[model samples]
Target: MLTVALPKGALLKDSIRLLQSVGLDFSAFLDSGNRQLQIQDPTQTAQGLLVRAQDVPVYVEYGQAQLGIVGFDVLQEKKPQVAQFADLGFGHCRMSVAVPSQSPYRSAMELPPNCRVASKFVHCAHDFFSKIDLPVEIIPLYGSVELGPITGMSEAIVDLVSTGRTLKENGLIELDCLYDSTARLIAHPLSYRLNQYNLEHWLNEISKNSQPLAAKAS
Candidate 1:
């Protein structure tokens, strides 16, 4: 059976909706009382695995799932060896450098070299700094990265910003936007190449029913 890895948070509903448009319904994952991490589509053509957004690529790369849905940010941070197929176009957000509102630094470059920048997306943070030729310490903060700057533990934070509500509430200001992120379709290369379990047919159906890559979906 073709197994799909579905992200568990904000993107869940949209992902299920996208799959439904292509004739696979995994909406059971969205039920308020549903507890099963793994659910088979009612049609018996495929199954879904509910997992953290960050782990979607991991499952696909390892062949535990032949296909997955995850945010572009997670793919950049994890860099798992999966074939990136399409951007599902929901979950709009951006990865940004943020600092305390009163901080002297106005941009990522203004921060002193080697200053501590906290984030859960350390890899993405590191690459951004490296591209700009800035040297800084990337602190890995799994929970509440805004605290890094708030508590004076770090000079800034590299994290996702959606609508800027959280940043505004915390008195943090965006210094620079690293990149925008959205949900994307990823597939295991081998499974995709072999078209196992009629995977190509499903993908074709999805492609026809959904927007093409890089096109935003409502």
Candidate 2:
């Protein structure tokens, strides 16, 4: 059976919806009491594996799952061996460089060399700074990076920002957007090549249905 790695957080609902559109049903994951990590479509055509958003690619790359739904940020951070097949276009956000609103640095480039920047995404942060030839100490922080600047543990932070609200509440401001992120459909490289479980047909269907929704003009 075709097995999919479904993300367990914010993107889960839409990922399930997209799969449903293509004729797979893993809706049991939505029930408040449904704690099962693995589920099967009623039709027995496929199965779903609920996993951490960051671990989606890991499962797919290891061949435990033929496909996965995950954020672009995770793909970049993990650098897993998988095929990035489609931009599913949900869970939109950005990777940014931010600092305290009152900080002297107004832009990423202006930050002093060896400045400390805390982030859960150390690799992404390092790559961003390297492009500008700015050497920084990227503190690997796995939780609440905004506190880095507020607590004086770091001069800045490299983190994902969905809205400026969190930063504002913490007296932080975004200095630069490194990249925009969205949910993407990824597959195991060998599985994709082998056309395992006839994955291509479902991929085409999902691709046709999940284009980024258009914003209605006022």
Candidate 3:
């Protein structure tokens, strides 16, 4: 069976919808009482694995799943060896460098060397600063990065911003955006190259159904 790794948070609803459009229903993951992490489509043609967004690529890369739907940010952070099939395009956000509104630094480049930058996405944060030739300590904080700046633990934070509401509420402001993020369909490299489970056909169907939606989103 073709197994898919579906992210378990904000992107889950749209991911399920996209799969539904391609005639694979995984909406049982949405039911309040459905606690099962693994589920089969009505036809049993495929199965869906509910996992953390960060684990989507892991499952696909290891062949535990032949396909997955995850955010671009997680892919950027993890840099998993998976074939990026399509931009499913529902979860839209940006990876940004933010600081206290009153902070002297206005841009990522302006932060002093050795200064602290907190983030759950340490890899993304480190890469962004490195490409800019800025040397700083990337402190990994998996929860509420905004507090990094507010509490003086760090001068800035690297995190995802949707409407910027969380940043505003915390008296933080965006200085630079590393990149915009959206959900993307990924596949195991070998599975994709080998055409496992007739993956190519489903990929084509998904791409056809997905392109118009992605275009609309763009």
Give the candidate number with the greatest lDDT.
3
- TM-score for candidate 1: 0.95
Tens-digit lDDT track for model 1 on 1-218?
Answer: 99999998988888898899887899988889998999899999899999998889989999999999899999999899999887677888999999999989998989999999999999999999999999999999889999998888999999999999999999999999999999888999999999999888877776655575336444
* Number of the candidate with higher TM-score, 2 or 3: 3
- Most accurate candidate by TM-score: 3
**How does candidate 3 score on lDDT?**
0.94
Better of 1 and 3 by lDDT: 3
Q: By descending TM-score, how would the candidates be arranged?
A: 3, 2, 1
Candidate closer to the true structure by lDDT (higher is better), 2 or 3: 3
Q: Give the runs in model 3 whose Cα sits over 4 Å from its true position.
A: none
Q: In model 1, how large is the Cα lDDT of residue 49?
A: 98
All candidates' lDDT scores?
Answer: 0.90, 0.91, 0.94
lDDT by residue (63-152, candidate 2, tens digit) is: 999999999999888888899988887888999999998988889999999999999999999999999999999999989999898889
Clash pairs, candidate 3, are: none
User: lDDT (0-100) at residue 15 of candidate 1?
Assistant: 88
| TM-score of structure candidate 3 | 0.98
The digit string of per-residue lDDT tens for model 3 on 1-218 reads: 99999999999998899899999999999999998999999999999999999999999999999999999999999999999988887899999999999989888889999999999999999999999999999999989999998889999999999999999999999999999999998999899889999999988888788887888988
- Candidate 1 residue 37 C-alpha distance from true site, Å: 0.8
lDDT of 2 at 170: 95
